[model samples]
Target: MAVGAIGVVFGDIGTSPLYALRDTFAGHHPLPLDQLHVYGIISLMFWSMMIIVTLKYVSVIMRADNKGEGGSLALLALINQHTTGNRWGKGIILLGVFATALFYGDSMITPAVSVMGAIEGVAVYQPEMHPLIVPMVVTILIGLFLIQSRGTEKVATFFGPIMLFYFATIAVLGLVSIAQMPQVISALSPHHAVEMFLADPFRGFLAMGAAVLAVTGAEALYADMGHFGRSPIRMSWLAFVLPALVLNYLGQASLLMRNPAALESPFYFLAPDWFQWPLLIIASLAAVIASQAVISGAFSVTQQAIQLGFIPRMTIKHTSTAAGQIYIPVINFALMIAVILLVLVFQRSSNLTAAYGIAVTGAMLIDNFLLAVVLFKLWHWKKPLAIGLLTMFFLIDGGYLGANLTKIPDGGWVPLLMGIAIFTLLTTWSRGRALMRQGMAEGSIPLEVFTKSAHSSATRVPGTAVFMASTVAGVPSALLHNIKHNKVLHQRVVILTVHIEDVPYVEPAERSTVKDFGNGFYRLTLRFGFLEETDVPAALRTVTMCGEAFDMMKTSFFLSRQTLIPSDKPGMALWREKLFAWMLRNAASAMEFFRLPTNRVVELGSQLKI
Candidate 1:
């Protein structure tokens, strides 16, 4: 299981009762409690959970795995693999990529909102704590990022029990309130939701954006499925988590109807004075886990992005083998900066809520779109069954998205700005890669004659040498530079290329392909699934099974690095080219991506621009 998977995947949606009820009442279109309004809000939350989380994700979409991995991109890859020639593949791919881009935006905002909201509980008990909120949040955020280098193994152990207690606390509180006001149980009816929407269509629609916050991190459960497996997650949701969530929401609403003055923080108001401070600390810690989950997910996604050619390869370190824990320093710090800025700019948790739901709901919609393709095209499910399931999910997701758009003028600009920035980066990197590949193709030299002549003339040295190549056929520019600088050749020379297949998982038999290029020279290519972690050194050891003995200590690895230069070329826009170049310059080296030993690695620089 992922170290903090349960907390990260379930916490955001789990904690929705904290503010969802209050927000719905006092949100963009504040609704008064009629029996119908209460029923409507409850009904919306129920079906939102049903369609967005359960039916669409847990039942249907989760089945569309890329070699037992599920996510927007992974699902996209699965669809593309099965239906490459279909007309809809391109559209589905774009939707998946777009969803992936939006997910980055959500990753940034979730930390800010979750942590800030939990810390904001201080204001309820002691208004004096308000002034220190931002700094405290910033400090905590910094501390969280700092500890990432060390990994989350110890911290993750507490996630399940703590979250279980948190859920139980809310459920008990709600049950108590329900005993007082039995009418709250009636809110589960569908009529209440429809009546509320029809009676005050505009206001009900506007409340959806805020309402959607209740289900913000639902996608994480699906994304992190590979870590915990489908059965455990499914069982957790059905048996304990879902009931607790619904009960707490109902209890909060029941309490509100009796005491509208409790509108400020119904979550805290539910607790007694003795329990408040402890609850605050627990909630705060839970929020940190929630934030950490998304941050780590961003790292995993970034690795996938690089593998699929949407981004450049970076140094990815696997922090733990048992838990599939990973840490990417560049991504960690980047997320830290963005999250802190979000907290500073938004100032309050309530304000951040506006920006939180859009990206998540948008991504969920894309997931449904891709899942439809999986069900009908890939899984070969009955078309009517797939259509029926997908339609329900789309309508619910559409409502949530429609609701969130109203928040744009409010504090919603935060996610929109982040989304645009991320989308630009993703598209630029993807396009830049295509152009670079084209340029490399034009410059490439055929290997047949060069290999024949070079192999016969070159002298053999003492040990093995591994050269990292960008392509299978052409000699890497780095190899040429290395040859010029050091005329001496190793006794055994291997040209190695690491390729990230667009699919999610690569079969073991297809992991690598090797050819004897005559003399002591050999050429090898390593392939990885988008969902599988890449450890080049580990892969090299396994190549021996394929009839290649890779002696690590004896192998000296060489890689090519490009310093991007902008030219008046008919390619990408000048600004994007510069941006791609900037990103490339700062990216981690191939030695790290391939897990080559530091002492034996060599880098060669070449100038290229798109």
Candidate 2:
């Protein structure tokens, strides 16, 4: 598992050395290649990793997992489990949701920057090939996305060893360079970082916009915790990944100190002339693995959002028997388009660097708020200690964020704009769904009342009918529509409500809650964790309470397909209502979403004003 964590969880942060040092010295916000500036930047990078990734995430944030799951949505769901009815719940939810929103921007930018940064090594070794860099990056990214549907299981088997080799190579390159200039090791001390910033406050602050790149994928540690577990990820970071990255950064600085012109591409220069091409190959592969991790993380986050009601149900395809190896076509293609555009527009890795750090820094700052709630309200840490830790975090993250904001006009606006648009879409869907549910529930009849009165009022059919509802209370629009149109009820009627719990998995023993409503009517509620996929037929097969076991051929599934009518109801703004209506129309049908048999399902359409 620790080896796997090296392959997957550390890919993003591990690959940071490719561009983090290069960009700091010669990026859009270029710092001098002198000893003072180089030492200062390396020192800051080391400290940022320690504080943000090690302290906040590894030591503290990973402990806030939701039933062994981690990520913004999982953490949000965990918070909701405890703080659902609190007055401040809504605000915290918005912050958590926006953190997810920022992640989309990060996802798009990561592929563009990481891939381009690695491929740029070719241009560094052979300056004549520079003109082909963007095209090469675009081609590589498109291939990466195209291969996503096939699943990463086979390829991922090689990832651990490949990453291990890459890390070892870079560490060796750094060690060789440091041997020539042993004094470069002195930069590891935090005092150099303080002294440099004190000597040139404004330039040092601006340089942070680029230096923050060193920890671009720090959040992946928390987000990918579920895949490898906390201990494996922690050990991978502390023992293997951290030492390699720090050594590589110090080596880059060491090279710069010996020859300032190495600033053009210190990472490649660290390698001997004969080893440069192999280093480039290893670095490019590492970049692909890093981008793959981010893309997969996007899929996972989108899945969580859909289950949590922040996203509309899209067509999700499982690429492997493993529950986690699933694919969403919409997310895949959407990310592909965004990444290709980023590469085309930004053209160079250095230019893309301007757009990179803002989203990451912004998300980290928001995590501080989420962490605050966990400490005070959930974990109940001592006041002074928690406050002191939080205060330090806020200051460090606030500085990074403020510095990154200065790059907005250059290219940082890209992620900020993307984050805002995605945030609006997520919140709109959630709010709109709530309003539509309320509108649908306006005149709902109780299940007990309907079942008691229903038997005598309608003719009895032979096979069972399962009417699905989002909630357990009252008669569903589908059930009401089915009886109203057909004027008949099945011999055995079941109103099934699926409740998505806040945790990641629910035990099979606890999934079904059956209540006999009398007169051949049974109210069934199936509980699922937020991370679990739904399969109505499969869950139903295990139930023996509906007089007899469910046979697929003898059962018919009924679904309510709401045709949202945008009106001047006191719900949402007109534009949002229309947006929700469009989303409803486009979302995957219940039969597809729940893995129900297509031939055995019936959809009843009803128009509702929200």
lDDT of 1 at 10: 87
In angstroms, the error of model 1 at 173 is 0.3
Model 1 clashing residue pairs (backbone): 209-403, 209-404
RMSD of 1: 2.5
lDDT of 1 by residue, 199-293 (tens): 98887888777778777788988888877778878888877788988888888778888887788888888787788998898778778878888
For lDDT, the strongest prediction is 2
Stretches of candidate 1 exceeding 4 Å from the true structure: 1-6, 85-87, 457-462, 481-491, 502-509, 531-533, 545-548, 566-568
Candidate 1, 210: how far from true, in Å?
A: 1.8
For candidate 2, give the lDDT of residue 601: 92
Question: Global CA lDDT of candidate 1, please?
Answer: 0.79
Q: Give candidate 2 misplaced runs (Cα > 4 Å).
A: none
Best by TM-score: 2
At residue 17, give the lDDT of candidate 2: 87
Q: lDDT tens digits, residues 372-467, model 2?
A: 999999999999999999999999999999999999999999999999999999999999889877877788998888987889999999999999
